[model samples]
Target: MTESLNSALGTISSVVWGPFVLIPLLLGTGLYLTIRLGGLQFRTLGRAMRHAFFDGDEEGNAGDISNYQALTTALAATVGTGNIVGVATAISVGGPGALFWIWVTGLLGMASKYTEAYLGVRYRVVDDKGNQLGGPQIYLKRGIPGGFGAALAFLFALFASIAAFGIGNLTQGNSVAAGMKDTFGVDPWITGVIMFVFTGATLLGGIQAIGKITSAFVPLMIVIYVVGGLVVLFLLADRLPAAIALIFTDAFTGTAAQGGFVGATIMLAVRFGVARGIFSNESGMGSAAIAAAAAKTSHPVRQGLVSMTQTFIDTLIVVSITGLTIVASGVWDQGADTAATMTSAAFTTALPGQWGGTIVSVSLIFFAFSTIIGWAYYGERSLVSLVGQWSSLPYRLLFTVVVFLSAITEIETAWLFSDIANGLMALPNLIGLLIMSGLVARETRAYLKFDPKLKKPKLSVEEFTAAQMPNWK
Candidate 1:
């Protein structure tokens, strides 16, 4: 029954994420947002980076977490196997050409990400206790008009909660167990138990705990992975240009079957590349907004600018490094490489020893572990949005239990199931973004222009709503 269900999910997953619908909807949303924002992501790249990396913590801020912490937490959720395994899979299945489309998707996604973060802050609910809760859920209902908003918000929360389990807990826990067992020969159950303990310990501390750990965890992990990947790229500097040329050329002309690749058309390259790219950076999914909404900052645009860096770093940098390393290592065409295998091979081949595989294994564990914790928080938010604040503990308990179970048992079907859920979550989010693009644009313009009255402190959710959408209540 489980096997049959998995097969059914795989088919449905393909339909849900098919190039005909999902790709265009995603890319089209990004394109629409870019036009609405007037290429704001590109223009404000420096400001966004400054806010994301170098800016000191905001004092007397209104939100829950620091801007940097929120960005890191979001990064923690996004920068997992998707960067390593997912990139390798895309290149392997879709060919080198896929990388180009992936790049395009990430580039367009920057605008979409910015809009999401903007709305996250703009529509955030600050309870009497000053707890900020926001995402597509709040904005979908609050930002979009009428009953459609409520329906869409509920739909988004439903899918997001479901996604939190598959993509968040089970898949991440499974990957950690797989990586640990492969590298250190530990039992999966042992790994599962240890992880569950660690997760339980941290969950007791709540978002602040998550923010602190992820802020520290995300930067170090990314730097370590990038530096290691750079060494491999430097080793293969001679082939870098050719590898890149093939990617560009084949993006349009299609890649012929070489080695075990079995070739790929432009359509296949676009489909897998875009899907995996979205999966990697999560630009259009609105999951990042849940984290961004909690950022401690006065200006929605300020936090929005900071949140934009998540996409730039996750895809343009981290995923690119992984993709390039594999291409440079000449491993994508060297027969079949499974989720973890191609990446492991690329690094091992570049380093010419077991060290590369060891690094991949170690990094994979850290990556997946961070994702497990980060998504646990996201799932908790989704549950709270659906039920109430009382659901937090139960959801956390459920998430950790799944963590243990997934560690002990493989969750192959959850991967495809998560894809379907992810696609569903994005639909409502993209719709909200479309409806609120004008408000985002207005807030951005008002903020950037240094509107004298608006510059001193952040607007409350209600004030923000009034200022941006004058017609709305």
Candidate 2:
């Protein structure tokens, strides 16, 4: 029965994430949003980065966390196994060209990321507890107006709740456990217990705690991993140009089988690239919008721009470093078993002694732990949207328990479950974004026209909310 269920899920996931369905829809929606927004992501990325990393939240803004904290919280959720393991998987299966497609997905995904954040803030509402709650649940239901909108919102929350466990929790926990076991011989149960304690402790404080913790460590973890990757790239400096050429050339012409790598077709490159790209950054998945909605900002457009930078950092920088290092180190052709360990393997080969594996193991553990806390919020919020505030604590407890279980167990099926749930989560969000794109474009253009710097919006949060979303209160 278990095998049959797993097989069933595999079939469903394949179809859900097929080239004709989600791949094109995700790409098409992002393309449409990019066109509608007038290439806003490209134009304002500098300003967006400023807001995300340097700027403080403007006074009188309505939300729980600062822009930087929110960005990091969102970053905490995104920059996990995907950056390391997922990128390696893409290159190994799809070849060097897959990295090129991942870039395409990230580039286009930036627009979709901006749109979801914009709407998340625009349609956000305060709960009875005075908590700032929002996401696709709030936006899809309220932004679209009526039964259809409510249904879409429900589906998003449903899938997100499931994905929070699979993609956000189980997959991360399993990765961390597996990495530790391989590198340090730590028992999976021990890792699971430690994660459970830390996860439960952090989650007790909710988003505020999550925001603070993620902000402190997310940047540090990223820098450590990136620096290690660069060292590997530097050691393989002579092969840099050729590795880059393979990324572009193979993207057009399928990679021929070499070493232990089975040759990949151009279509295979596009498929894994797009799939893992979305998995890594989660630009259109609507999960990040939940964090965006909690950001302290005067206008939706301001936070939206800040939020999109998460994708830029996740895929364009972190994933790029991992992919390039693997390709440059010449270890990506070592067959399917190497996907999870490819990045570390590359680093191990380049860096002397045990430094390479240790760096990756530590980063993977922290990245996975951060993801657990981050997704705990997403899942709890999702439940709150469905069953109201009463479910939040129980859901968090349940989520924590599951984290331990996932760590101690073999969970290959969890990846399949996560892929399907993540894809399904994106569907309603992409559709809603397409439907409400006009609003996203109009508001964005208007906001950018007035305060391109986001230092001060023409109207404060109150005035802006009242003017644009009069019925929100």
Candidate 3:
């Protein structure tokens, strides 16, 4: 029965994430937003980086955390198993061309990220406890207007709440467990218990706590992984040119059977590449918008810019390093047993014995654990939107339980199921982004006109919202 269910999920995942469905919708929505926004993500990335890493909170800004904290929190959720195992899986199943498609999602999806983040903050509301509420749940309903919007909002919330367990919970825990077992021979059940405790402790403090923890460690973890990957790349410098060519060539033409890599069609490459890319950075999934909505900024555009940097960091830099290292190290064509350990194996091949694997195992542990904390907040918020604030604790507790359960289990099925849920979660949010692209573009233009460099805006957020978005909820 389990095998049967896994097969069914694989088929459904293919259809949901295939060329005809989410591929076009995701890419088209992103392309449309990029044009509508006049490539704001490209033009403002430097300033966005400054805001995300250097800027402090605006005085009197209505938010629970600084923009930097929010950015890191979102990064915590994103820069995890996807960057490690997901990239490897993409290359293993889809070929190196998958990395090229991943790049496409990162570049184009930046616009989608900006639009969703802008709308998330634009339509955000203050809950009864004074916590901020946002993301597709708030934006789709309030931004769209009428029953259709409400339905979309509900579906987004439902999918997000469930996706939290799959992508955010199971896949993350399973990866950490798998990496540890592969590298250190640690038992999965032991890892599960320890992770359960750590995740639950972090969840008890809520988003504010998660933000503080992620902010402090997320950058450090990323730096460690990037530096380790760079060492591997340097060792494999001779293979760099050929690897780059293969990625581009295979992107258009399918990869033929080679070594342990059975083979992949052009369609498979595109599908897995896009799927893993979306899984890695989550540019269009709208999950990161939930974190962006909590940022302290004077304008939605400011927060949106900072928020979009999450994708740039996750995919453009981090995912690139992992994928390049895997391809260049010549471990990408290894069989399924290497999928979870591909990055580690690549690093091990370049560095002295045990050191490379140790770094990767430690990084995976931190990455996956941080993701669990970050996504717990997303799940909590989704439940709050569906039920109320009353569901927060219960949801957190349940999420912790699932982290343990997922760690001790096999995750091939989990990955496929999570991909489907992620696509479903993105569907309503993507529609909302496309439908509201004009409004997002207009608001962004209006804001940039007043403060192009992210300096002090001429108008206060209240004044700007009241004057420009008169009917804004």
Best by lDDT: 3
> Following a full C-alpha superposition, what root-mean-square deviation does model 3 have from the true structure?
1.4
Sort the predicted structures by TM-score, highest score first. 3, 2, 1
Stretches of model 2 off by over 4 angstroms after superposition:
1-6, 457-473
| Number of clashing residue pairs, candidate 3 | 0
Tens-digit lDDT track for model 2 on 1-473? 76897899989977987888999999999999999999988999998898777776665568899888889999999999989988888898899999999999999999999999988887888987898899999999988888999999999999898889988898899889889998999999999999999999999999999999999999999999988888888998999999999899999999999999999999889888998899999988999999989988767888899889999999999999999998988999998677878888989988899999999999999888888899999988988999899999999999999999988655557777888889999999989999999988987777667676777643664575567656653
**lDDT score for candidate 2 against the true structure:** 0.89
Select the stronger candidate by TM-score from 1 and 3: 3
Give per-residue CA lDDT, model 1, range 91-141, as digits (tens): 888889889988999999999999999888778886434578889988899
lDDT of 3 by residue, 1-473 (tens): 88999999998998999889999999898888999999888899998888777766665777999888999999999998999999999999999999999999899999999999998888899887999999999999998889999999999999999999998999999999999899889999999999989998989998889989999999999999988888888888999999999999999998988889999999989999999999999988999999988877777888899989999999999999999988888899996567988999888888997999999999999999988898889988988999998999999999999999988777798798889999999999999998999988887999888777777653565677678878644
- What TM-score, over all chains together, does every model reach? 0.94, 0.96, 0.98
> In candidate 3, which residue pairs clash?
none
